[model samples]
Target: MKALTIEPLTRDAFAPFGDVIELQGARQIPINLGTTIRYHDLARIDVTDAGGRAIVNLFRGQPRVLPFEVTMLERHPLGSQAFIPLTDKPYLVVVAAAGELDPEAVRAFVTRGWQGVNYAKGVWHHPLIALDDVSDFIVVDRGGEGHNCDEQALPESLWLTSEGLRGAAG
Candidate 1:
């Protein structure tokens, strides 16, 4: 199997695949008598298709060990999907661009607990890869949809290394 090194998640590096959800360098607006700071419009929630609506749900993700094997990737054709960790634990994100499923285009990102990601519509990505412990995430995605998901099995398996990924920023 081929090996892929996981990189740190950053906004600029992840732009082709999705939006990085973090407060760093984000627009802030104080609201409610200046008691709360609002990070407004951080991610583009593109569920504007007919009969498409946004829905919020809590996802309990099972943790996966290092040197994980990746055999498949999936995409949402109708709407976007966002995953925001609800706990202070690191997680893994694997993604490719929005076109052909080129194995060479695949990239991996390890995120801090406070970070979240919004996968753009038709963006190819692996499912949640929570680590450390059983984690819960606040997921935002489309509800009413025709078959919104498409899965593709890789012709060859890939391996992800957990080491050499810490503290390396994109």
Candidate 2:
């Protein structure tokens, strides 16, 4: 199996796959008597074309150890999906561009607790990978009629390592 070195998540690095949901470099608006700072339009919720509705749900994901094996990836052809962590725990994100699975084109990223991601429609990505204990996340995705999800097994399994990601920006 091949190995994928995890890199720190950043908006620029992740732009090809999706949007990185974070307060850093985000548009901020002070509201509610100046008691709260709202990050406006952090991610684009794209479910309009699927004839589906956007739904928010809480996902409690169990942590995974390092050197994890990635055998499969999935994508939503009709809509996009976003995952926002509810706790201060890191997570891993594996992604590839839309189209046939290309092992060499795959990229891995490690995200901080404060960061989230919105996978664009047709972008291939792994399922939620929570780290450092059970983590809760706010997942926003399409819910309703058509089958929006498409999954594919990789040509070969890939191993992902948490190495070289310490203190990296997320």
Candidate 3:
């Protein structure tokens, strides 16, 4: 199997797929009598589809060993999903554009310990691949009627190893 190249997560690089939830260049709003600064509009949450409502969840993900095989991808056609890491550990994100899953169009990224991602509706992506330890994430997604998740098996599996990681920013 061929190894995938894992790029460092960046807003520009990840824009085609969805928003990157980070505080680097987010809009700042001073609230709480000027005692708190809010990072406003970090990501767009779109869960209102087919009677679907936005729901918040706490997800604890087990760590995944390196050289992980990516054989399939899933997507939510009805709503978007956002994952905010509660644990300060790097993780892997694999994604393909919304539409038919073309394995060749797949891209991989490695997040900094503080970075998070929001996969837009209909965007194809692999499940969370947490590293180092058991990580927790604040997941915001759709919850209601209608089938949302769709999984597709890749034509061939790709392996993600440590050596494949590119600029894993500290």
Candidate 4:
């Protein structure tokens, strides 16, 4: 059995692996919406497209807490889009790739990397599993319009707990 680790989500920390989309602090910017108001850089956001055509949908809803047995699915030729965690204490389930096609030595690794949005596309990963409540996510993907979407399940099960992430600090 493999123990799951909770990692803190930070821009600098997650930069090595993928784009970290979260507001580090407030930066005032002029509002151009036919009104005069200051806009803050609430979160660092990035957008992805395919052949100048976007295939993603943005939906707003409360964040969903995941179970310990959360398993990841795999995809290829497409990138991933995720939401940045905003709660004071947020947790995420990160899984590494496994199989002969996986060039990495590790097999199905899981740990917490960032509290904000982090995703791996053209890479192997699990489905949506939230760490807190009321998380607003800006989804990025190749748009589920075609048949290129591929998902493969893992044999070994994994788990996540709040106690595990208590000591992680960004």
Estimated TM-score for each candidate: 0.95, 0.93, 0.97, 0.60
lDDT of 4: 0.47
Put down candidate 2 lDDT per residue, 61-164, tens digits, no spaces.
Answer: 99988778999999998888999998888899999998777878999899877899999988999999887799999999999888888889888899876553
Predictions: Cα RMSD each: 1.6, 1.8, 1.1, 5.4
Relative to the true structure, how large is the alpha-carbon lDDT of every model? Answer: 0.89, 0.88, 0.93, 0.47
What is candidate 3's TM-score against the reference? Answer: 0.97
Roughly what TM-score does model 1 have, to 2 decimal places? 0.95
Q: Is candidate 1 or candidate 4 better by lDDT?
A: 1
Poorest 10 consecutive residues by lDDT, candidate 2: 161-170
Which prediction has more favorable lDDT, 3 or 4? 3
User: Candidate 4 versus the native: TM-score?
Assistant: 0.60
Q: How much is 146 displaced in model 3, in angstroms?
A: 0.1
Lowest summed lDDT window (length 10), candidate 4:
102-111
lDDT of 3 by residue, 1-170 (tens): 87888889999999999999999999999999999999999999999999999999999989999879999999999999999998779999999999988899899999987889999999999999999899999999999999999999988999898778644544
Clashing pairs in 3: none
Q: Write the per-residue lDDT of candidate 4 for residues 1-170, one digit (tens) a residue.
A: 45466566555555544555543443656577847555364433232434323444554445444335645455544445554443354445454543332322122222242334545554455555554554444564554444445665555555555555554544
**To one decimal, what is the Cα RMSD in angstroms of model 1 from the true structure?**
1.6
Which residue pairs in model 2 clash with each other? Answer: none
Candidate 1 regions exceeding 4 Å error are: 164-170
